[model samples]
Target: MAILKQDLSFLKNNVKQVDAEMFTSKIRGIMDSHAPQTSRTVTDRTSSPWFSVESKAVKQARRGTERKWNKSGLEIDKQIYLYHKKQVRGINLTAKREYYNLKFSEVQNSKDFFNLSNELLGKDKNTKLPKSIKSELLPDTFGDFFIEKIEKLRHTLVSDFNHDEDFDDSQSDASTLSTLSPVTNDDVKTTILSAVSKHCDLNPMPIYLLKNC
Candidate 1:
């Protein structure tokens, strides 16, 4: 922080004659000197909302254990450090759960519930999409996926619809009537089944896709 202050002070005292590019480069260099370049980065304990005085103490203890384990490479120290890591996870999880539970328990209406729920589930957590079949998605992603499926179904129903083969050849108007008729869910299902029958392997369909017509 002090380094940042000093760097900013230099920027503040910059001359009008200084080249804009050189001034920016100097600021970047100052920042680089103060910032971590290693693969492992440690965030300040005070940055987390759940982090309290006790949390800081626990974190320091864990770090001390980690340092000792790194130096000695003892099995006992390794176990102790692992235990501290587990304890820290539990502390953070419990603190977050209790905090949100308390905050949400007071929600008395649908609007309040959704507001609190959205707040608790941060933007990054709430906007995630499914990468594959087994992967979990954000709540909105599931709804959007289904909505798209329904739209596709609607398009398929209107566009790919064919005249019924079962129509009587005796009736001259049967083919015309079948083509002109409005599409129904049963008709959509029949057309889908017929198309799948050509494949014959009967690949299992996704359960989500089967939720509606």
Candidate 2:
């Protein structure tokens, strides 16, 4: 195609006769005729490459058992779910280890290693600030950003007190119950929030808002 394009008479006639769209399509057709389409769709690329067919089948089975566990009143139903869950976990772990090992074999340097690591761990591309947000108050507003992180951490770890009992029951079995001092969960949350407040609450909200604005 490059050689064909080089003929002076051909180039002059081609441009004179073909519209822009037709010219583009001809070039594209030439390229596609040589190579198969290798691009992945968004959904295909977003899913874990380590997840194999066997792993997917095991995971499907696990989810089936989880539904059974949720609806059935029998302890045996729950036991079956646990068994499937373990099988799924084991298969996924082996798949991921093999995946990383395969990647490790291909890497030749620190840059390659880091790139592969990012592929495995995922990059924080979604968390970036907008490119237009170039605020001069960013330095002084650091306090607000830090406070937001603290609030998110607190909310995620402790959650609401109303849901604690059910969450605890779901996580515990007779053999796995905590053996620590009989401190109530609510009490612990209160202690943590109080400590956060002692340090954070000393500053007035207006001061942070003013700096941020």
Candidate 3:
């Protein structure tokens, strides 16, 4: 943070003259210098969202103990491994319970409540249509259906058409949006502050860092 502040202080004098692209590059360079990016491969298997660092540590310890028990074939080692295994299970259950409890408390509407309920019940799996579905023919099918319906409706309307009916323009409501108010400095600040703190490859720095600076 101190480094960020110090680097950003240099921008005060040349803020007006600095080009947008150059400014972005400079900020990105500073960020990369302090926090270099690293890559990791993702797999299909994922950890539970409720799992914490403590749970991971305990699980790792359990694995170590189990390995020792397997190697030594000692009764005491087996008991210690069992103890750690139970601790991991208990921690996982407690974490899951607390996580769902908090989620249930924060639900504001029936839709959200039902969604959370489905998540808890493991019923929120992605829905996919069968491969046998003739999706390629759907556009033509939809076009034909709509065309036939519209043709029938058009014929019915023609039979019931009243050409002598007079329209009343005065019955319509009047509305006009001639101008928008200019955005103020406070509005800009508020928008930046309210923006999500997510960072992407294109972003020079995270919004949280921008806010702090």
- Clash statistics: count for each candidate: 0, 0, 0
Which RMSD values do the candidates have, in order? 26.3, 34.5, 11.2
TM for every model, in the order presented, reads 0.36, 0.37, 0.42
CA lDDT, candidate 1, residue 209: 26
Q: Per-residue lDDT for 144 in model 3?
A: 94
Best TM-score goes to which candidate? 3
Q: Mind giving the per-residue lDDT tens digits that candidate 2 earns over 73-155?
A: 67999899999999999999999999999989998999899877887788753555545546776655777889999999898
Quote the positional error of residue 156 for candidate 2 in Å. Answer: 58
TM-score-best of 1 and 3: 3
Report the CA-based lDDT of candidate 2 relative to the real structure. 0.68
RMSD (CA, angstroms), candidate 1: 26.3
**Highest-scoring model, lDDT:** 3
- lDDT against true structure, model 3: 0.87
> Model 2 segments beyond 4 Å from truth?
1-45, 123-213
| Model 3 per-residue lDDT tens digits across residues 1-213 | 887788887665687778998889888788788888889997887888999999999999999999999999999999999999999999999999999999999999998999888888889557664465498976787789899999999988876675425556577687868999999868987998898788777888887888888
- What's the distance in Å from true for residue 90, model 3? 0.4
* Candidate 2: pairs in clash: none
Relative to the true structure, how large is the alpha-carbon lDDT of every model? 0.68, 0.68, 0.87
